[model samples]
Target: MASFVFKVIRNAFGIAEHVAPGLCGRAAFELFCRTPNPRSLTAGEQRAVDQAARFMAEARRHCLTTRKGRITVFDFKPQGGTRPLGTILVLHGWRSRTEYMKSVIEGFRDAGYRVVSLDLPGHGQSSGRRLNMALAVDAVRVAGEWFGPFAAVAGHSFGGAVAVNAAVGAVAGIPPLATARLVLISAPSSMPAIFEDFGRFLNLGPRSQLAVAAEVERVTGRRLEDFVGSVQLATVPIPALVIHAPDDREVSADDAKAFARAGDHVRLFWARGLGHRRILFDPEVVSEAVGFVTARPRLARVN
Candidate 1:
């Protein structure tokens, strides 16, 4: 298949191996600090954003664990009713903090599920030299001890890759992350493609793409996109709910459709005009995600 061949070629050239370790860390930090072009934020809109984030910081508790060493988490404990219908582990998109996605965390919780969220390495509470695939998975798995056998794991944008890396594969020999289902919000289909798209967005040159591949390779110990089938994920086998907005400027809807087709268990819900990050706030969007997840029941932890 074309995908398989791409995987082989991607690894051979070290597409993500253009530099020494941790370069992506530096790159990601620089990207995160730059203020996005603010688009018409009414004072009310800004305060609403601030208030929601404030709630999470005040409401959630921190849990730390050691995988690669001391991972930090913001976990919302079940409000003590039937062991929480289920716990939803949430991963935020690139260059965004966990607080910005409060609607997602609150959506799962309001629907009667516990929630665990992390600022992926180099992003939020977790200490990191950089943000890469392996560290991403390591952060989730370490937090897994506190949020074991979750009902489903959900991620948006780049975090979608982290969700897959954690749920379907064994990281550093940590007990395989156990989750019954998956939810990908604006998740991309391939890392090579993600790099290309992001590179174009940032106006990155060939050197930038090469630097990304190199940094990703260091963290994962393999080609960045080689993870296409690292677990059953390249062809997701578990129940997966994919939510994407047609108007997303960051990732292509066609790619999401392609990724959705890879899994028989995947159910795709396309929104007519929701923008990338705004998808989290759309009632119609949240309604679908919460419905899909809550429809599934719970079970005890395996290990």
Candidate 2:
């Protein structure tokens, strides 16, 4: 049933592309950038959301204004009211809310670090309906300036790409994110690949694909290739961790290797059997991430 629907949509786009490449391209670009409505939570996800609510109840909430719109940030102090070791900023993935990152947030908080996390411009409890890497990077830059000089910045999936770009100053006009370390989980290394994949999914032809890319470039004031995560990570100059599952169906494991190979400053941890989203909740993955964030800076290779 789903395949049939997708085929119908693909054929529609195909016909439209031939009839009016310009309009079809614009439509494709809009659909490509459109943020999907949040999915229905599973029983476990619901519990996580409930626990996150309780966690947020004790947090210091801030509604930050940005060029894109207002965004909500939650500051979670170290557990037990202990003096925080340092502050860590967390970013959630596409179509995901900060609540979904409760495990990671709690891990950092329990480890004596103050954790600050926010919904991106279009996700969760934030403003706006559309989002892209440029807007996301700008949002992170604003957050960094507001609550900055972070001990580390960690992000998952799309958020991970934003973290890398923000950290490396990939987007023009926005200052690089201020942070000491970085962590990326299941992140795509190339923006162009994402567009290519989207085109394939929609069965977009040459003209439509070119049009979508052109529109994206115009909107971002930079080419999609400029947002390559591995290239940016190579210049990060900070100790970084790339955590990924070998069999992640959404993001290829090759992307993870690209990040690890970017530079010796970056290390990759393979979270076998966890796939993509499940990795966020895995106890071992959380422990490894927390330990890296809390530990003193050093180069450690993980096999």
Candidate 1 lDDT over 23-90, as tens digits, reads 54346424533333333355765676577765676555675755554555777855545368878888
Best by TM-score: 2
Tens-digit lDDT track for model 2 on 11-114? 99899888888788889888876885545566776677777787778888899988878888988899999999999999999888899888898889888999
Question: lDDT for every model?
Answer: 0.67, 0.85
Cα-based lDDT at residue 95, candidate 2? 82
TM-score of 1: 0.73
Clashes of each: 5, 0
Runs off by more than 4 Å, candidate 2: 1-5, 38-47, 296-303
What shift in Å separates residue 45 of candidate 1 from its native position after superposition?
10
Query: In model 1, which regions exceed 4 Å deviation?
Result: 1-49, 63-70, 79-82, 170-175, 197-215, 229-236, 296-303
